[model samples]
Target: MPEAPPLATEHLTRVVDGQTLVADVSIEVRAEEVFVVFGPSGSGKSSLLRLLNRLDEPTGGTVYLDGTDYRTIDPRTLRRRVGWVPQRPTLIEGTVAENVAWGPTLRDEPVDEARLHELLDRLGLSGFADRDADRLSGGEAQRVAIARTLFNDPDVVLLDEPASSLDAAAADRVESLLADVMAAYALTAVLVTHDADRARRLGHRGVRLHDGGGVATGSLDALLSG
Candidate 1:
């Protein structure tokens, strides 16, 4: 039998403002694989990603990371293990290097300069270490956000519409960078996106979210072309 996935959700449900965002959704995400959540606007994709990282608590059910119930774990520690990149990139008021190093610094881990450089290079941001983050373009800022998340050495990365704001070329660059990162780090990734093509390119398995708390999981093409 195949090994169990690193992340699993069992009968997960979320209700906000008396609205049922997600209902009894179950998912298994294996290590070294990219799993994508695709849906139309307000279909609970972002809410689902938030649940995975504990950013948003589920109204009912459980999330397991590496076989441990996430509710039993500390949220901060869980966040450290599961990185998140939001839809809008928000950079601190500092140099690019500082922002990239913030997570490790907070954890009291000595910053690994070589790894930092490699991540920047991989994201096509080589030599941007000294640039002020506030001055970066939208796509560049997004890349820096991704670098910052990677700096934590998280085993799982959750990205919500990472490429939505970028131009075509920049979006493609982000996609390629994510693929490289997954291979290099052997990381499990779950991304929320509306772009079917992007999901097909990034994920082997796809989950589609719809109204009435319906979820269908299968091949990327099946979800996209449904």
Candidate 2:
């Protein structure tokens, strides 16, 4: 039998207050590749991502990580393996280093100072370790958020409109940085975005959501064109 894909969902659905946020969405993510979920605003892209890591319970169906059902794993453990980065960066009241090291710290694991610096360097924040997290610019804070997620060594990363709030140039930089880090770490990613060009640039295969359902699925180019 063929090895199962790194991440997948089967007939997943989520409804809130009798309103469906995601409906019967299913997709497979190949290892080390970027699988995109793209759609117009309020199309349930973010909702779908949240279910993958069980940030919200699915109303129906399930997600699989490495062929095993994700629901079987502990929520905290699942989150550690499947890191999430939201659209806007939310940093605690501390220095950049503190934020990046927060994950391992929670697990009572010793923070690897060297690894923290390496992640900062990779995210182009090499000398900002001691800087206050709250004081960074929008783009800078977002990069710090990405670094924080990577420091956990997750097998898969979920990014919800990661650059949506940035200026055009800053958005471009963040996207480029994302590609580099994913490649360098062999990380599988699921990115939610409304930008067709960004999808084409970053996604290998993707699905487009429309009103909480998957309207199209295939290679990024075909999905966007359809």
Candidate 3:
């Protein structure tokens, strides 16, 4: 028998007010690989990520993390394990340190300062620990959001248009940081993006969503030509 995938969605569907946003999305995300999800504006890529974390319940189908259905687990506990980072990160009203510490704090776990600093170091946020979280630039905020998610030691991370709002330079820096962290931690992730170039640079398996039916394909050149 084969080992279970790190993340799997089986015939997933999401509907709101009789409108179908995502229909029958099924895919297996392998371990330690970045799986990019690309599609048009209303292709339901974001909806799929929300369904994986159970932030939005699927109208039908199942999301399995490590082969166990997510619906059977506590929502809060599942979220901590399966972290989601939005395009525009939302930080709490406090210093950067406080925001990063919030994750472990929720579980009554003592802050792991060494590990925090280590992850912050990777994110270029070592010195900004005591700085105000609200004072960060667009790219810096995204980096901070990523570091905060890492603090919880999540098994899987979901990224929705992670660098959609950043400039070229800033976005490149953020992507570089992610590549480094993902490699170092061996993290498994699914990222939603409209940029085929960005998806190519990330270099992984991918799927394109159209009308909720996913095409199991991704090749930078092919995507660019399409």
Candidate 4:
């Protein structure tokens, strides 16, 4: 039998502002696999991603990470174990290196310069270490955000529209970078995206959301073009 996936959600549900945002969602994300949540605006894609990493608690049901219930895990520890890259990259006023090192620093882990350099190179920010993170372009900053998330060496990465802010060319670059990073790190990834074509190009199974609930589960092509 195949090995179990790295992350799973069972009967997950969430409600906000007196309305349901996600309901009865269950899915598995395997190691080194890119699992994408696709939907239109306000369809609860981001909320679902947040639930996986425990950034948002479910109104009902549970999230499992590596076979453990996420809610039972300490928030700080769970967050460190599961990295998150938000839709809009928020950069602290600091050198790129400082921003990337922030996660490890918080965990009291000695900075791994080699790993830091490697991630920067892998994410195409090779010469950006000393540059101000606040000075980067949207695409560049998004890449830096990814690098920062990987710096902690988490088992899973949650990406909420990592490429949504980029132009067509830059978005393409972000997608390629994400694929490479996931493979190289053997990390489980859950991404929230609105672009159907980008979701197809990522070549991952997709979970579709509509009307604040999971509508279907299938290949990106089947779900998006259907």
Q: Give all candidates' CA lDDT scores.
A: 0.88, 0.93, 0.87, 0.86
Could you say which candidate leads in TM-score?
A: 2
- TM-score list, all predictions: 0.95, 0.97, 0.95, 0.94
Give the TM-score (vs. native) of candidate 2. 0.97
lDDT of 3 by residue, 78-113 (tens): 998899889999999898888889987877889988
lDDT by residue for model 4 (136-215), tens: 98899999999999888788888898888889898889889878877888777887888887787775887889876788
Candidate 2 stretches with Cα past 4 Å from truth are none
Clashes per prediction? 0, 0, 0, 0
- Per-residue CA lDDT of model 1 for 21-109, tens digit only, reads 88888988878888999899988888888899888899989899888899998999999899999988989999999999999888788
- Residue pairs of candidate 2 with colliding backbone atoms: none
- TM-score, cand. 1: 0.95
Rank ordering of all candidates by TM-score, starting from the highest: 2, 1, 3, 4
* Residue 43 Cα positional deviation in candidate 3, in Å, after optimal superposition: 0.9
Q: Give the candidate order by descending lDDT.
A: 2, 1, 3, 4
State how far residue 13 of model 4 sits from its true place (Å): 0.6
Per-residue lDDT, model 1, residue 30, is 79
Full-model lDDT, candidate 4:
0.86
Residue-wise C-alpha lDDT for candidate 2, range 1-226, written one tens digit per residue: 9999889999999988999999999899999989999999999999999999999999999999999999899999899899999999999999999999989888899999998998898888999999999899999999999999989999899999999999999998899988888888888999999999999888899899999999888898889988
